[model samples]
Target: MTETPETAETPFDRAAEFDRQVRTLVDRGYPSLAGVGPEAFAAAVAPLRDRATATTGPCDIDGGRIPFLLVVARGAAPIEETMPRTTLHRGRLPGFVDRSFEPGSLERFVVPEEIGLPDGDIYLLLDVERGEEFCGVVPGEAMKTVAERKRTPLTIEEGVALVTHFPEVLAKNKCFSLGGSRCGDRRVPALWISKRAPKLGWCWEGNPHTWLGMASAGGRSAG
Candidate 1:
């Protein structure tokens, strides 16, 4: 049978490819997560599946496409907004907002509204030297919750508490085991060999940066 163009598999679909590896991690454990393969994430994000934004191009981290959504929530504001203090960095992964250097430092972003995103939207987010930050979304409000529109970045502890309280978002990973790069301390989530999944090792601090590093989704999926 011929696969529809919409359903056809491309050679380098990164998100689908990573999802496939997650299934493999499950297969390896055969019903025991052992702290890896964050499959519960799938169920948590289910409410927004119909609301996911479509893209024909690959994700910046993987250079391949996946079903991850770009939120454009309803009643979203129409102005292009950005965090005035946010710093940019070049790391192996995409979607990272370079700010936090220590475990207690606060990283920040404007909600979809300020960015003209549709209401009630969610998307994949990545970070270096830290656990992945996908749950940064606030369900019913913009992330910046001040009348003046200024947010106090959540302390790492505070942020992790809210996100991982569900048992689905194990974002305690600071990736500090992997030392910082000469450029900076950027790392990604990782899986270990002893069956403790998502152990968080390997640094992205090297020259000749490849988009796919051990911390990146593509490199992890390919591994």
Candidate 2:
């Protein structure tokens, strides 16, 4: 079968790529979580729509062409609520919080002061990488590697956003850790395929799981 130009994969098909992202979010009910309807939420993202790009290939530690991810800030849509919306194989997985954390534990896992994030209810995460290489490395060692490469690790919200927008990226045996957000402790939050569904769980920082890597991005921009 011959592939038409529209059907063929391109690195930068601006309009089609951006529209697909908008549809993905709307389908996953991100607009409702942001206190807006699908149309309003998409309109809010229109100003930055032209800047959207697709992840055509792999990203390296030094940086590469990573896709731009549309993120609803944690403040706007809490992880607990957004997580359950995540789906895999038509099944919804609960966003399980580690029992070690208190009831309000998520609030304590704020974006580090050093990482200056965009100020808004919604924004664009540039050069987002799934951190496949860091899979076998411990969270502690992965942090050093991420820092050495001049990249910021992803927070819990960003992790949810990544999986929400790109479900195929959260494959079994290739889930990732949200090492960016921490509560001054060693517990690192992660998203993995649990019981054939996507789950938000945590792992110890010093421990290395062969299936988990640390997710990161180059930086963030206001949407």
Candidate 3:
């Protein structure tokens, strides 16, 4: 009998998944959106590709939780670039922001200093959780629970990256909130399946939604 590859336990092939992510970003023109050349952007993420292959186990899909090694483009890149590129429906449908929000308004949403994100133009988010367990809970309460767990809430850019790389994670009745980024106000940004497509929208902090959960991550790594 031959020894089995550990990836057999995973829902998808890790190497293939990683390749798809990279190819999607390159194909979707994410490099230019981030003000970088396509080849340079691909080179920058080459290390992550190497790292993914070297890792063992099931690639963090245990019990239906999808853990992502997110390659986030922030700082130099405007939110507008990443937001509209988030795709679903097998990359056919493009993402859109709620009509209520005007272009460039997302700049007000800032990551809290407490999150201690790594400094970089590009960075890595490790073991990102979609926070499915927090559905039906208000953002305020869910945030408290997240703090108790010692996990960091995900920013808008990070949330976009999750769906961009792994659109399958954004399932029906399983949308998530981006409480990690906020202005000095009551609004919380979120991504959900809206009008048969992926949407970047906002909800009140005090509100609860049975369909939406808070997204979070183990931490950030400097790329």
Highest lDDT: give the candidate number: 2
lDDT for model 1, on a 0 to 1 scale?
A: 0.24
lDDT tens digits, residue span 1-223, model 2: 0111232353345456567778888887888888899889988988777556433333221322246778888777888788887776445564454455678888988877888688888888878888878888989999889989999999888888777766667876778898888888888988888767787778999999999988888887774
Q: Model 2: C-alpha RMSD to truth?
A: 4.3
TM-score of every candidate: 0.23, 0.85, 0.85
Tens-digit lDDT track for model 3 on 1-223?
0112236453445567666777877877878776788889878777676555544334443222444555665675566777678777465677887876666778788888788677666666766788888899999899989989888888988888887776777888888999999888999999999766789898899999999999887777763
Which lDDT tens digits does candidate 1 get at residues 1-223? 1111133353344345334433432333322322223465344344433322322333322211222322111122111111111111221121222332344222222222322222232233222112222123221121223212332222222122111211122222311111111122333222211122222223232321222122111110000
lDDT of each: 0.24, 0.75, 0.75
Query: If both were scored by lDDT, which would come out higher, candidate 2 or candidate 3?
Result: 2
Q: Which window of ten consecutive residues has the lowest lDDT sum in model 3?
A: 1-10
Q: Candidate 1: worst 10 consecutive residues by lDDT?
A: 214-223
